[model samples]
Target: MKINIVNPDLNELGYVIAIANIKDKHDTSAPSDYHWKILKCRMIIFSNSSILACPDKNDVKQVHIIFNKAGDDYDKLISLFVKFSLIQNGGIRSATPEIYQKCFHYTMTARIAPVWNTLQDNYLINNRDFLVTRGPQEAVKYCIVVNDTFTVIEVNAVKINLMLTEEEFLPGEWIRVLPSLNKAIVEDSYKDFSQGSKFKSYKNLRRHWKNIHGYRLPENESAYYSIQFWRGEPLLYPKQCVLRNFPIVIPTSQPLEKLIISRFVTCLTSKMANVLGTKLIFKLEDIQPEDSKSLAPKDCLLETQAVSLCTPTQYSRSQK
Candidate 1:
């Protein structure tokens, strides 16, 4: 358990708002597993209000703003705020090389869990001026501080969010600490919670997650993705998705049969990716009749089988 030797050079980068661990999803089995695994240098991004975050380049490439000050990237910054305001902590499965180029996320350390707060706060937590200051552990020694421009509303929101985090849930829903029994299991594993946590298996955890907390664990992979991308309703595509009512997006547009075998890897695997070079996704609004096939209807696309529209592909296997 060795923390990053090289600290992030804050000379040109923005203040450190968050930090990521440098380990695989399956790395954690002990409390101290996180500290040493964190690489600080990778997080030192050159941005306006960038927060220190993400140890792996594959997890997060650049930084987003943290304050409410009027800047060119106000919306962008607030969006980050919104993102953390409602993020998932536990996950369904594991995927290698998580980033944008990949798809989905199945990490144990997904958000401000009690274990997360303990590990991170062990590094440090103090408000030099206002609400709260959580920079690198060096922030305190260097007499550093958190953002100063937080409004009363923002400060209250932060307090509320923190409270919710303490309770072990994300914002806009519920947040709090789990029972000691549950926490015992949750903080242990970084991946593969389905292995059975003191917290419980997927069935038990999912049940407690919903019944006790009043929130719902995504049963549908697309809904899981929905929870991943935006903490809103899942935007499931009929064919691409695997849920009876939701979508299950893969890393790549893989075959229907493959989804079950790979357990989500080998293509659109269960992963979190930071980079997807030059590919962008835009949420279409009022789609018109003139849209392309790519812009499939958002509504449950239903129609009677018109004909055998099947056509053989150029692939040798398809011809057979």
Candidate 2:
């Protein structure tokens, strides 16, 4: 493996770019065997933060790393950093060009797990004079440090957020409405919820809806309606979210199931909102169940009578 460092003489912050190359020993004319192929990779790092950016160009025999700070281990991070550098140097294949092109356009927020405590302590003490103190609540901040060999990257935190209770859903009587109703709510608020939108697929929408709102599938089978909130604009990427008022309503009468779902949603939403530096709004309502097509009371009745359970509050950081 060989490494090259490239510094673009453009920005004042002085972004540092590193590229890695791995030679393939396998003969190209030989039969398609694993032993014949060589592995090559690339990666990029910004001076301002620890987040890794994908390459803007492409080459053959490339590998891409999916950023998941919470779930990725130290070994995985090291592997990704190497590949990221390779990608930055145009040594890897460009399977997803859009991702690489948009990599640097957005900011990523991630928490430092306790596993990297030693690294975090070292960075904090070394950069103590440059640290900025905010409110009583400590905000978590991390930076990526490369070694002299330029083969490894270490994640270190200068500050951390105060631990807060996870948001959860409470047990209550929720109205059961047709899936069409949920669709209508989303379409009304977000123009991108249409056919050409990224959320056109029900399965994709459901997955993201559950992930963003903190709803989880039940352990056992049971018949019940579920209420979920859809916050943010209907964008292809959650990190590109602009609007933050979309709400999803799932009506369920099952007390036990509703309680479980509510608690899970609440806890997850609170944690996600805080981590993403977004505000959360909770709207609760109780009304007589009606037919999906019938407008006995009016279409806007719920919106007018909705009660706010959680008001939006700014957090210290936002994660992708």
Candidate 3:
């Protein structure tokens, strides 16, 4: 990666331009897939009384904060706190690109899972151009991270929601997780213990349970288990993501696969940024995979800088 300083007149602007090549060292292919990526330097635009600060940028073209080098951007932020570290740390040395790529990959995978699962599970798939992939990897990253918990629950609705509605069952009815009765008394025993009565219909029962009780589990069994209501949607293995089957070649062979991968990476990156105590602002750019030929052009690429302040100023907020 080479660092380019464009607009020297703005050199005092406190931003540095760092460029690096991302390569697939794991692949023994002759050229070893590679791509040139860029990062904009940053200055502390805002800081709180204590430890963390929200960094901002003057350039809005980039999507993610580029560490230029690689290796746990999450961890990299930590070293920034060392005695004297303000964006320009040791002049941007070279390191592993694996972490950046993985971070992006995981993030994208996590985000797309919910939507994909929704389509597959509910059999409600559509391509009305209603996709939620119109932002930088970093921004998309946060969207997925913040929204992942909700998406997961949506994907696995059955295990989450209560099968019966207050109206479907008598007002004072109750059903337990166990097929057989527990020593626990149902103060509201008016309800039938039969699974059939627990839900008015399998589909509605599953949806209701998901919406109402997605986060809390029934208080009966101690052992871990996955309760399947119906096989309507194929189950996604834990830790398995939509990008698992995506192609390594640029300009991915599969459209859906590429989309899933890109979304996951962008989302996960934002998640990591939040943990690092930074507010990530992202801009989305479109570059076809076939057109990507630097090193290993990532499924999703991010050009990130930091934001020091998130508070909406009178001028900015009023414009809205």
Best by lDDT: 2
- Model 2 per-residue lDDT tens digits across residues 38-110: 1121112222133334321232233333232333332454665554333232322321323322332222211
lDDT of 3 by residue, 1-320 (tens): 11111111111112122222223221111111110111111111112111112112222221123332123543444344332122333343222232223233233232233332222111111111212222111111111111211111011001111122222222122222221111111222222223323233334333332232121123222111122222221111111111111111112224543454454445434433332223433433343546333322223332232221111112210111
User: How high is each candidate's TM-score?
Assistant: 0.20, 0.20, 0.19
Per-residue accuracy of model 1 over 211-272 as CA lDDT, tens digit each: 22122344532111111112222211111111111111112122422332232121111221
- Model 2 has how many clashing residue pairs? 28
After superposition, the stretches of candidate 1 with alpha carbons farther than 4 Å from their true spots are: 1-17, 21-57, 60-67, 71-195, 198-285, 292-294, 297-302, 305-320
Model 1 TM-score is: 0.20
Better of 1 and 3 by TM-score: 1
Worst 10 residues of 2 by lDDT: 1-10
**Which lDDT value does model 2 have at 135?**
18
Worst 10 residues of 3 by lDDT: 153-162
